[model samples]
Target: MIRWALIFLVVALIAAVLGFGGIAGAAASIAKILFYIFVISLLISVVMILINKSKR
Candidate 1:
């Protein structure tokens, strides 16, 4: 997921450089959303790990 977000971020940068405003905007938004999701999932996984450790 983080890889995908980076890919989209690269695409957005390329598109912006080429003057593709709409494509750049869309790609950037997608990248932002994917990044947030990745962060949230990572946080959840960390919390789950901590909880499991505490249960031991």
Candidate 2:
């Protein structure tokens, strides 16, 4: 997921450099959404692991 976000970020940069305003904006927004989702899921996984360990 993080990898995908980075890929989209790179695409956005390239698009911006080429003056593709719409494409760059879209890619940047997608990258931002992906990054946030990845972070949230990671946090949830970590919390779950900690809770499970503590339960044992």
Candidate 3:
């Protein structure tokens, strides 16, 4: 997921450099969304793991 976000981000940069404003904006938005999702999931997983460990 993080990897995909990074890929999209790079693609967005490339698109912007190539003068594709629409494509760049879309890809950048997607990348930002994916990055946030990935971060949230990672945080949730860590919290779950900590909670489980505390119960043990």
Candidate 4:
């Protein structure tokens, strides 16, 4: 998931550099969304681990 976010980020940069405004915007937005999703999931996993440790 993090990998995908990075991929889209790079694609966005390349598209913007190449003067493809629409594609660049879309890719940037998608990268932002993916990054948020990845962060949220990682946080949830950490919380779950903490909860499990506490239960032990």
The candidate scoring highest on lDDT is: 1
Q: Tell me each candidate's TM-score.
A: 0.97, 0.94, 0.94, 0.96
Q: Per-residue lDDT tens digits of candidate 2, residues 5-37? A: 999999999999999999999999999999999
TM-score of 4: 0.96
lDDT of 3 by residue, 1-56 (tens): 99999999999999999999999999999999999999999999999999999999
RMSD to true structure for each model, in Å: 0.4, 0.6, 0.6, 0.5
Candidate ranking under lDDT, highest first, comes to 1, 2, 3, 4
lDDT of each: 0.99, 0.99, 0.98, 0.98
Model 3 regions more than 4 Å off:
none
Better of 1 and 4 by lDDT: 1
lDDT of 4 by residue, 32-52 (tens): 999999999999999999999
lDDT of 4 at 17: 100
Instruction: Candidate 2: give the clashing pairs.
Output: none
Better of 1 and 2 by TM-score: 1
* Model 1, global lDDT: 0.99
